[model samples]
Target: MGIFEFVANNIYYTVPIPVYVAVLVVLLCQVFRRIFISRRPSIMESTPLAHKTSDLSHYILKSDSCPALQVTPDTTYSWRDKPQEVPREIKPGKYFLTMNIRKLDPNDYIIFDERFLSEYRERQAIIENVGPGKIFVADPSDGGALDLCEETLVVTVDFLVTRYPSMFRKTERGVFCIDAGEEYDLVTRPWSRHPLEITCLLSGEDHILIRCCDDGTLRVAAVGLVYSLNIDWRSFIGKELGSIHKDAHVPFYESALQKSVDRYFQKLPPDKLISRANWLTQVGPELRNDNFPDKYLELVSTLPGNTITPETIVNDLYIRVERQAMRKLPSTNGVVFKFRVYATNIWDLEQEEGIPRRFADHIRGLPEPILRQKHCLECADCILKAMDFMAEQQEKEKFMNSYD
Candidate 1:
């Protein structure tokens, strides 16, 4: 008999009616169960900053290595414990134009130090001297920028007050800063100022760069650069990420680094926060530097290779480091970029363990192009020689102390 005829005969003669009915009932029950589950609330989708957030694709889809990334809430920062002293993260490796990023806990997002009061005053004075338009600014036309800034400001206030209750408190009169002696009635007071400016006054960090994604492009929507850090942030507002880097004259960004950064921004999830540090050698004053690159080049050119010595290295040259963090905003689907700038003596940098050799190596590793931009070409030899002198002095002291 043919295959079709044999199967037809088996369906009628071999199979029982109860067996067909049971199979049909089982299939119908599975369909109804799935429909009920689809209507139910999911624990994973409930919270943005949950231990784990998953979509239906997580169950239905499978990747080659399905490793799950998780972030644990830090209890120490939440409880407002004093943070320990951290050594300068400045090192030899990852000094080049690269995104050296790592996980950042939400609790320890904003940093406060002994210099908070001074920094706050300095920034406010800057605002007074120069208008808020030149410092803390937002794009007037971009509605998304305002919403993103306001939402971020709200988050910042709650985060700071919760993390450091002793410093930031909520009294009968709205939020208060103990050190600054400032109070704001968030409810009744007319908010004449921009949301980013308000955020600048409340936090120890003066520089806040906000980039919001619009139509697949991430652009600088608002900037709270209260302190003068060379380039004016007002001009930076509304420029896309690519233009910002190009305007800042970040070396190799357009050529080698833009695509990588774009990919990183694309993959950044709302629940994750990442931090990185970048360093540059600066000559003269660390603050109020307008057209820093041209000025840096001019200053370096005047001091020829012959004039640099160990005595004047720290006095003339400074190692300026910036610790930056990129945080994903769940509410607005935006990214808030924050950076804290610190200038340390090059002498102090060499004093750190293994830094002398590592620092020397780092300078030599860079190509001729960046070396010229960073002014490493002008000072690298002198800096290395001075580091050697420091190293020799340390060895001599150690040998002398052996008798003791």
Candidate 2:
């Protein structure tokens, strides 16, 4: 303990106040440097510059902005200026110009107003003619050769109206160009009194022509272009009929007569029915004629299965003849007739009543009268007439069967 105490006391004394003060001063300098001297801004603290500027020059210079004056590079002319002094006057050389409006931001459009910008001065005359294989245009008098460089080539008003529908709309009698910028109503004068027909010739872009016609038939050429082929209905019908005859299973004469009658009836309007008076006038004598018996038989044999009896045959014939007459008659006074005949054979059997009398009674009981007085004799008389005809046919068939 004595030795440690002695050594501690000596060191405390030897390490003087000056040495402690120097070490404290050195520490203070380091603290001061950290607080005030060493702090500085980093490289990342710099200000940023803008990449783009807001420019509105395009929006300011619009067609609508200055309505009276045309803002062109060569010359600006106001609408109030004399028409003759305006640069818009048609000159001799063909020219086209592109016009841009600020409101339509994305696109600029072109217009061909003057055919020649230099030679014609103001008034231009156009002479047009159709040649053998080309179209030629010149000035009628000799002011200057017509120039079409700036002009829309061979374009008709119709073509322009069709191609650019939004640009043109139809009026009551004509068409006019639409102006998106101003209210100027612009309509092109027709080149001639007649309508102009524009067609695209076989050759490419260079081969368009304008043909003028008085009648409004210019659209026909366009229709022909769209539909190049034609169809004939009569030719098709003939071919179909020939095919039917070629494939027929029945005799040609019989099949033809049946088909003709069927077709004729099919063509009749539904409201009309054949009648007895018309049947007798048109086809009854033909059926009874000796020379036409074969034809008559051919026609009759083609009747439907239910029409075997003489009464049914006569009814069907009357229906067909009435239909034909109604189709041929004018609307004014066409008489429609109705008739019926029924018969039964009274061979050596119990004669309760003749079959014809029973059939006639059935006809008479129907809701509608089968025959009016003018169209038929007495009902008994009509029934007897049919009976006589059937009896004759039956006898002939019997005689033939006996001989065979």
Candidate 3:
């Protein structure tokens, strides 16, 4: 029989067609799933802080691993027994006050120093992620904004030259050039390049340049960020600081208080600088993008209980702390909000005397509404697991140390 005729006549030939179709369907399903998952921005993999691994059992835990355990609910736990004040209430206007900010420390102003190897790696990650789009976008209608950009650039470059002399150099033509090994031609504007260079040459901290609008509003004009965590910078470009906080669930942006915040930025003296630190617990220590409510909902909705467990929580979890500073450029009158991200492992918190208890107590004290806003329902199981783990580790260490 001819080959085609034989196959056509054979019943087994029919099986291959159906099997091929089945395989194609399965592949299509997988492709769609992948596309859906990847549509959202991904967390860029970057090197974490130095000393993250220096003492794993201590207060500095660092690892690049995802959650591996399924989250389990612990109903028998009691957090009231410890009673420590932490996770402070989002008291309105607490950090934005006009208290006399001390004479600025150059080190405090610059969070990430390029002298560290890990910070340099992070800078590369940011440059890679902040591609194509101008990191500094000027309000097109504001003709004077370009002047402000140039002025901000000069102020920043001068600050870098004066504060970190070794990291910067001036060309014979007096053009300030960063000492980064490679050029970043993609970062076009001088203001953008200045912060871009700072990000690439330094480590740890991210920079945001907020220029004062003639209308008394402070606009976020530029940013050098690689460790965005959950923030989407594109949305905030050229937006007023008060308008930026408009959607925030917190009461800090109440109309009267927002006016004060705006006033504070406007009247902030060039000689003074202020700083604050905020803390939270995260499931992973990666310093890149973290899909907050949307991605968190997607993951938890599909596989809520299976997404995390105590082991995974403890293994992958981190204490996320943001050290933020606000200062005004003497020349441009522009403001800079510099943020340094510090992630410590839950296991490490056990080393400290009262940090774990205090943090947990604060978490417990948070009102249900705020907790809901923070998406605690999805991550509550894992958070509870971390708290319990920290407590157990704390007691174990204390018991062990008593003999010494």
Candidate 4:
């Protein structure tokens, strides 16, 4: 009563006491509701960063659980009706396209989605950038890449003919018909055209064939690597698994993960299929090396130093995710691996509650060997900055929530 009397007497000499008391009551209710009744922002809400934020959020926010490998009965990929444009790096005048693929926690072994249009568009762009010569490098003497190329073509044609005969028919010229104007000679083709057909049909997906050597080691035989990140296809074509993953501490005999990987390959039956995902971040969309068709060595020669700034790392960075699928070819007894690459901005990470903190924690906790293998030393400062910024934001949110 004293408080009310004081307010009524002192608020204003001209104002009515009842009107002032009513306004005071309304103001108090609003403050009380704001502090005690409202809910905080939901962690699962869609972020402004990417259209598929909700889908990607499930993977980013948690350590993926290793699920049982399932067989994908056929190769009829669900195609997106429309293809969306992804960002590419901008060089002063020249344009360079890049796809980011990073190491990921153990997740589901394989994924088959309707990505026909998306894959076709990216494949077209890759072809235009790299051309046929570099995109499909299969020398009969090199053996594996070309052999795998042929096998992949056969499988692709078989799938098309069997599953979607309306879209694929047999031509009188001994060619497989895609449409009235388009026909592919899967049988009589030169070694080169086999890879071409594989690329044409599996537009968005990149292929690499691995075969066991006489010495009981695995080697990368052939790769339809149109969207490679940093590494050249030629360099990896004939390399062993250990040599390929040397930087990541993957030892054939020593590391348990390495041993399990080998065991998985050895035991993977011809009809069984398995897949996994890997993720990484880069400063910009210009990830694929400029060595697509030609000038690989030239591009390597002029490559920039590994120096990067926190500002650039934070502002220019984006996430790169690769969905990898592996299965054994019943005929050749060789394993085919598909790397389907996708990119999303790191800002997507900000959308999930506790994600930024989790990312910061993971990066901070990385061991020296793993850190070096990730090539994260150069971007360490920027990455750390991002982590810290996320932490600060989280702290501010917590403080605000405390009142509620």
Better of 2 and 3 by lDDT: 3
Looking at model 1, report the run of 10 residues with the lowest lDDT sum.
59-68
Evaluate residue 257 in candidate 2 and report its C-alpha lDDT on the 0 to 100 scale. Answer: 51
TM-score, candidate number 4 = 0.58
Clashes of each: 0, 15, 8, 14
Candidate 2 weakest lDDT stretch, 10 residues: 219-228
Q: How far is candidate 1 from the true structure (C-alpha RMSD, Å)?
A: 9.8
Candidate 3 clashing pairs, residues 3+ apart or interchain: 58-348, 69-309, 70-308, 70-309, 71-308, 86-362, 112-203, 229-290
* Residues 233-280, model 4: lDDT tens digits: 676767777677774353232443445556567666765655555555
Q: How far is candidate 4 from the true structure (C-alpha RMSD, Å)?
A: 25.7
Model 1 lDDT, full chain set: 0.63
When 2 and 4 are scored with lDDT, the better candidate is: 4
Best by lDDT: 1
State the lDDT of candidate 3 residue by residue for 1-404, as single tens digits: 99788877985755667887899999999999989876742222111222121111111112221121112222332223323222222233223422223344543455333234455665566656665243434455544444444444444444443444444433432233344453322122222343344432433456677887778878877665666554557677777777776766554445446777777889987767677666555666676647443244556657846664334444556666667777776545777776777666667776666566666665666655455545454555666666667777777888999999
C-alpha lDDT values of all predictions = 0.63, 0.26, 0.53, 0.53
Write candidate 2's Cα lDDT for 37-123 as tens digits.
336432112111322211111211211322211222212322223222111111112222211101211010112222213111211
Deviation (Å) of 191 in candidate 4: 5.5
After superposing candidate 1 on the true structure, give the runs of residues whose Cα lies further than 4 Å from its correct spot.
Answer: 1-87, 91-97, 188-190, 212-214, 290-314, 395-404
For candidate 3, which ten residues in a row score worst on lDDT? 52-61
